[model samples]
Target chain A: MPPSPVAVSAALNVVEVAAVLAFAISGLLVAADKKLDAVGVCIVAGLTAFGGGTVRDVLLDRRPFFWVERPQWLWGVLLLCVAAMLVLRARHFAVTRKAILWPDALGLGLFTANGTQAAIDLNLPAVVCVLMGVITSVFGGVLRDVVCNDVPEAFSDHRPYAICSFVGAWALIAAEAAGWSLWASLLVATALTASLRLAAVHMNISIPPWDAGGGGK
Target chain B: MPPSPVAVSAALNVVEVAAVLAFAISGLLVAADKKLDAVGVCIVAGLTAFGGGTVRDVLLDRRPFFWVERPQWLWGVLLLCVAAMLVLRARHFAVTRKAILWPDALGLGLFTANGTQAAIDLNLPAVVCVLMGVITSVFGGVLRDVVCNDVPEAFSDHRPYAICSFVGAWALIAAEAAGWSLWASLLVATALTASLRLAAVHMNISIPPWDAGGGGK
Candidate 1:
């Protein structure tokens, strides 16, 4: 028998669409923040949505990437960007813009869960699955950062639980393999990432320091 | 057998250094054109130097990248950007400055060589090696464009034989596999890429339009 699809395996096609839209918003927000031109905004938004999946496909040697296989993903990003541009020109968006960080954070959570699940479905080792989750979750942002000319926050000192996404992904996988329901595992994983990130931002919590063997701070 | 030290690959290495420096300069020039700050300049220069290689490694699953493994590469890029800034500020650079286009073309030639050689060393299939070469040559500039709010030249309608790098890399590989010496293969590939690019720039060369099956231009 063929192996199972990842969590919500039967409903994966739906999840994929949602994940794409979420990440597209992540890209769109950055483009808007930069006040990019329409073409520029669309490209960035599309890249943010599909970049991680593309990297995953290349790494896993899966051909005809997600966006390539499903051209609608690209269309969605383009349309979304165009809509965003229209909205921006029509009125100055306030703090409660439709494409806000919270929605993006939800997308990040779903992507982290789905990516981990996909890696697990590939029958890779647990550590690799977790790594895949982190890579997929933060990849869009990393591309965004690189384009914005900043060192990737995921690799830098400031962010908390950017690494925790990897940890949570592994936890989800372990639970699923131990006969937990797919929903239970995904819920746990998503909650872990969202709460950790939210707390980090709001409470200014951080991961404890490693011993650097130096006197600098 | 152990691979030859990069030093034994002296001319190729020199070309690689020149390529990296030229690429870094292009990145810095763009940043300066945008009137960005010092951190932004370093970020752009560093990305231009390392972005292609990093993308290649991630795709190939090669971890602990060259810049990460040899921190000296990062230091070199940082110093180059700093030196450029000092020199630019000390005098009006326009009279003395060679335009970025020539250096960008030169960088493209050398990076194609480096990337082709690396793929060959890895024993990837010939098509894959050629593809890797193109990735190594242009993805940095693509990333730079995306971040700087410009369309990627690679995907734009009007760019020249950026595609030629892939073609030349394959030719070099086939020649080497057919018993050509390393130097001979390198010369042929480099000359083909540079001359073609110059011709394309001067002659307004472009990809020939496919004869649409429906029979329209």
Candidate 2:
């Protein structure tokens, strides 16, 4: 049987909360690495956690941002930043490429699902919805990397990161087109994206960097 | 006597156009320096020219982004990028710190006035209006630097960049509060900001970086 609406709403909430925490942690890691002040650290963390949603809302012309709607998310990020700062040693703080990928994959899936669903609910064009999904999953990391003075790995890493979200969004669209229920579509898309990301990394799969002559990255 | 409403509107239009052109050129120059493709150059240029205004509109929950409202801007940027690519050599593409400052100061001033007026029209709180103005003036450069894999000079570089915009925005607010005409308020704010930025640059004045205990930028 299809999941009840109440169960689905609860699941969606859990997924969103988890995704925000994951993105916030990722941002704080980079900010702390930069040796920024506490205020700077929290600011960067907040940006990373909220950047995608803000962009999505902006593009859709929606009002009262997600954080504004649930102000607790702001406190949650602040608390998380403080706790992580206290607990993480330099050793624990050491973030390898692989180390960043796991949580990123999971967050990517979760965010993409949420973003695509939001656009789809508005009956937007499929392409627009997919792009929104990709933007939602990828832009936070882009903001994080950009603030840290690095080229966004989403654009530069030659990994299948955004492409995974793109495909996952398409999957959700396809599931809905095929008459699947809302929760089922979201879960399937999320699972596909996260697993696909993990598999790509495990196998060292990559995308071709933009062929910007011989000089570009 | 205060300027006629028609003249004021015309002047505001001129300022907005000039500011966008200036910023777009700034972005294209940096992207070309990196040997980005034609598409990349155009994208960067568009982001730099439009980023701040987009942020403002997003923050205010405004519909139909400026570019969307004026689709011709998309074409204008594309044409400008292509023309620039044809006319400029690698030597011309070389941008010094000083080189980026002049047009930037002008754009900062122009955008700040427009942005502040926008928020003031909506009767937002003074602080919110001022911040909106700052974001409108400063975010384009922030976006440009971020895309180029550099930390935003606004947040780093120990320069009195955003602060200048802040003061300029307040100037606009102050003028309006003093019962100045709308156009007069805008010009006063713009002139104050652009001149202040030039004066600061000429004098080698800078803001102190965040005290990251000898670690951060």
Report backbone clashes per prediction.
1, 0
The prediction achieving the highest lDDT against the true structure is 2
Clashing pairs in 2: none
All models: lDDT?
A: 0.70, 0.80
Model 2 residue runs over 4 Å out of place are A1-29, A35-46, A59-61, A66-142, A149-217, B1-11, B61-64, B68-75, B90-99, B213-217
Model 1 has fnat of 0.03
Put down candidate 1 lDDT per residue, A95-141, tens digits, no spaces: 53443556566666777887887787788988888888887788877
| Candidate closest to the true structure, highest TM-score | 2
Q: Report the lDDT tens digits of candidate 1 across residue range B8-113.
A: 3565556567777878988888778777799999998888888887787776666687677668878999999998898776255574345666777777777787
Tell me the spans in candidate 1 whose CA falls farther than 4 Å from its real position: A1-51, A57-118, A121-217, B1-12, B61-65, B68-73, B89-98, B207-217
